[model samples]
Target: MALLPAAVPALRAENLSKRFSTTLAVDDLSLTVPTGEVFGFLGPNGAGKSTTIRLLLGLLRPTHGAAWIFDDPVADVARAHRHLAYVPADVALWPAFTGQECLDLLAGVGPGTDLAYRDELVARFGLEPGRRARTYSTGNRQKVALVAAFATRAPLLVLDEPTSGLDPLMEREFRRCIAEAAERGQTVFLSSHKLVEVEAVCSRVGILRTGRLVEVAGLEELRRLRRTEVTVDLSRPAPRLRGLADLPGVTDLRWASGLQFTLSLVGPPGPVLRALGETDVARIDVREPSLEEIFLDYYGEVSA
Candidate 1:
């Protein structure tokens, strides 16, 4: 129902830039996450992901750019933030207090927190409300932080590597919870390196490399841009030198044995498959490249 009055973008960053004394942390990046979705923010280490988040939260000023939330300029972030909840990568809570105490403290910071929902999270996250923060494990502490954040029914949730210390079951819980939130028209900006999570939760993604955005689109669209792997099997040793590498969309070839070989395939498999048709093949296999490989095109080993 994007046509609805509330269907406009919940978060937008246009030409957002930030700088240090000798480095540009964020450089002319622009992206928009519409209502009722989870948008993934991905980038490598030292890619200015954190810096950008700080800018959006008004924790830092932009060098030359603008940010908006719910159609309001970031200069009024304090007002816009009432509709947003931020879950930082690090768990920020007092070490000598019970779980309930920390959530109560967070509740005091904003509106929408209720005792009923707060109690629900204590159980949902498997946290012992009576236990102090110092007695909790890293993952448990993370759970407390999330419980505090999600307990607020904020329309926009800005998460930075939120599941860093969660267990598999908790991560699954988080995915289900986020999906439920989206069903209710809540917007999520999930920042992380977890490809699988993004693939499962986000409706679209924006890739940041060296403080700049290079791509923004649906998950399937990004996957289409990545290379595919084609494995061919033969009964015995490989044939003499062939024109395999020169074929259209063929790259990074590897010969496992006389009977097996693998190569990267881009575009439709027709051309390469047709060319290899001349060889005697027992079995054929094809699969999409890993998300890491696809992302590598943006955040490669070297900085952009």
Candidate 2:
């Protein structure tokens, strides 16, 4: 028999909140991420996602409650950071230093770094180490930061919009690296606005609205709340086909021509499937809603 891995808390927050003067950046937020999990933190502009990341990184003090990384209080930056690596949304580098020099400096200051792995990442990310920092583009700068962070061999990775400037190919590489990190027993705390990327890489996600957490669940669970789109073509014209719209979980019915129509559906297909069986169906197509669609539903509800 194989032994199962023990449950451990890689990151935890208890009623964590932050305020700057009269503005409340985070509101009574609390969350826990288990070891070896890739957790997504999702929100739109001004949603306090960045503030929460800062609080966990010990860059900002919480106005209420507390946060911890591997049992070490986040208030102690030196001790807490020893177990994690961080990559910010906006990466800035010294203009005078070459990319290689910057990497060396970062590796020297971090807890522990794998020089061989760092070299492999540099090649995989297609970074020009000899180029001066001032000569690098936004994407290249981001690559430098990614290489340095991944080389640290830390137990946890805190990434905020880590793929902001990468092109499609590089973005694919980044996702592959994240999967490899998970295999190595490293936890990833990903804060991203790219819904597709989050849906592809994260096992669980938490949604935030107006500095407050509104929902947290696995992707499959969240998908249940979203509507699906179904388009169908009938063998013959039937004016009564519109009556199918009256079925439960069906909405936004529209006709394309004499025998074709489209509608939005929610929940199980059993009800819709039975209704279609009654008609002489020629063709049918169904598509699951994207994460972006579900996120918009939450955002719209909050805005209203």
- Residues 1-304 of candidate 2 have per-residue lDDT tens digits of 1111337589999999998898888988899999889999987666788889999888999999899888789999999888888999999998899999999999888878889989999999999999999999999999999999988888899999889999999999999989988888888999986667887889998888768887888998755656889999999987877797888888889999989999889778888888788889999999866555666664565531
Q: Candidate 1 regions off by >4 Å?
A: 1-8, 225-251, 256-260, 265-293, 297-304
Stretches of candidate 2 above 4 Å error? 1-7, 225-250, 254-293, 299-304
TM-score of each: 0.80, 0.81
Each candidate: RMSD to true structure? 4.7, 4.8
In candidate 2, list every pair of residues with a backbone clash. none
Worst 10 residues of 1 by lDDT: 1-10
